[model samples]
Target: MEKIFDNTEAALALKSDSELERARFLFELIKRDTLVKIGAAVTKFALKFRLPVEGLIRSTVFDHFCGGITEDDCLPVIDRMFSKNVHAVLDYSVEGKEEEGQFDKAMFKILKTLEYARHNKAIPYIVFKPTGFGRFEIYEKLTAGKKLTQEEQVEWNRIKNRYDRVCGKAFEYDVPILIDGEESWMQDAADELAESMMFKYNKETAIVFNTLQLYRHDRLDYLKELHQQATEGRFKIGMKLVRGAYMEKERERAIRLGYQDPICKDKATTDALFNEVLIYMIKNLENMALFVGTHNEESTYLVLQIMQRCKIAENDKRIWFGQLFGMSDHISYNLANFGYNVAKYLPYGPVRDVMPFLFRRAEENTSVAGQTSRELYLIKNEMKRRKLVKSV
Candidate 1:
């Protein structure tokens, strides 16, 4: 309420002049939809053919957007952010693996992060994708209410087991774990699985945080229903509320498959849905905890105002403000500077394995109205405030 986010020095305190320049250049490129699309295509082609582009990619976007290529690789970043009081959520960013071996590998990777979190206060949480632990087709089939073959059922059971293994360890370590939301078709089954984990592990506190992609119109109702069930079942609900990342995919698929589009009608509808759900969860803070993940300034301020109105301490453990590692520094760092609980989603993996995640980040920046430009503006303002850039 005191206009804290405008403090460029505090917002970019951790960034040196070189890092600020790099962020400016990257956001400038991301502002161009055509350029981002062409870059994504060319990057995919380069990675596909094993061209010698990993170093270039690593020096640029990878360093900006991700912590590192491995858990050990991320240590400096984790330590530096925690120096500013911003916590990290170690995310293994590898995507789109269908093999059982790959699933097991992802599970092991998360288990390693949980171990890291057990010893490090810098990492307050760890996260995983539901599909990362199992096959997407299995989740889709289960969500559709279709019968699974014996082998498919076995795969599904294995997926559930993977969830339990990581979640059980999280409970043991006393670290909160976040499960990311995926596209609508596959999310129902993942939601059910996350609910079961919460019911099992959240009896004392919220250890398992399921994602709510509020861009979907039905997610508010889903939250209400889940809340009712959570209350009656005597378990706490931990949720990561996001504006969603798969809007284009969701809409195109709905049109192709002749089903109602699961997305809100437009940006306004999605924004309203996100805020409405935020308020709903805030009101029920006794039984529910929140990880408010957004790049929108208005919504971030809204959360601050609500916390003040509810007399919730800025450092409340049950509530946190989260943003991506490479984006929204003003929101993440400034909030942390104000004694608020804040975490950045620190995505990391091998360069090739993480390309898909990077592509989506670029596409999301381009598609979201004003997001890229706002980032550019803030970075430029910060640079000028630091005397690294000339005033217009």
Candidate 2:
């Protein structure tokens, strides 16, 4: 049967033979659980002590997953994807710095990204983490209903100012921006700020987007509530939907704190909820702009099926699909090839700075059952086909 993800040539169009070989080797390592565990530990130790393993990592997982170590370095990757009809969302992948100076630097970097995106028609969106501009402790306290100290009040104001500057620039450039979702504890603050920005900048169009993680049992309802608010408020809602990245951390935290887990009970529940939200947003497409960020083939097929049933155009500006830059090219390239609106989340940063993001990608592949193996199978199939074509 023909499948949405069956177009291997479209998927691997931009990959060199050497790149495919590297991916195959990396996925093979990721598929071995014992090796992954040992590798993760060794990587952590080496990075902690500032060992010279950067070259090994840069050539392996980093090359497979990230765009490059700098904005200029990402131009070729961006141009290559755009050549295939896929757009880009430039994501600054730095994480886990809390100093005020660090936050200021991040804000400057994001604004620079937006400025760069302004001239590049290939870049449709810019994204940043809220914690990149504010302290996690401040968000946690705010979410918990605790009053901020006098110093924190000033800090919060600065955070708000940074958000306004970013959103305002996005609006000025007529480019959309995504405020990524984080842990449940700090999500409330992010949501509140995102909604406020949407109200300000999304009055005419969805210039500011908020992310919703559907792995939480409560998020589907949260989506419905936001739709209702948008209806009443007479503004558009821009939403980026994902199955979430912090499931294990969320569950463990709930267990440790003796509270009800906020996550869906199982993967099936999360999957059902994700599809339900997708359908709901599609049905309400008039007032909603949806960005579906997922690697799941079933979810991608579900969206295609619903759009076909609803007679939505393949090139609708209000709807888009996204996958991480280095993964899920089958879905991205195939959809783009067929004239669907698709973009890759192209994360870029210094090698040392993006290590956390890189590590998470590796851990996710290893821990998620069948993920690495599936990637390996696709690469092998594509390689065989290419070899056959050459021989002929």
- Give all TM-scores, in the order shown: 0.98, 0.98
Error of 1 at 294 (Å): 0.6
Superposed Cα deviation of residue 138, candidate 2 (Å):
0.7
How would you encode candidate 2's per-residue C-alpha lDDT over 257-277 as one tens digit per residue? 999999999988988999999
Q: For model 1, how does the per-residue alpha-carbon lDDT over 1-392 read when each residue is reduced to its tens digit?
A: 68788777888889988999999999999989999999999999999999999999999999999999999999999999999999999999999888999999999999999999999999999999999999898999999999999989998999999999999999999999999999899999999999999999999899999999999999989999999999889999999999999999999999999999999999999999999999999999999999998999999989999999999999999999999998999889889998999999999999999999999999999998898887888899987777854443
- Candidate 2's C-alpha lDDT? 0.91
Measured by lDDT, the strongest candidate is 1
Q: Report each candidate's C-alpha RMSD, comma-separated, in the order given.
A: 1.6, 1.2
TM-score of 1: 0.98
Find the 10 residues in a row with the least total lDDT in model 2.
1-10
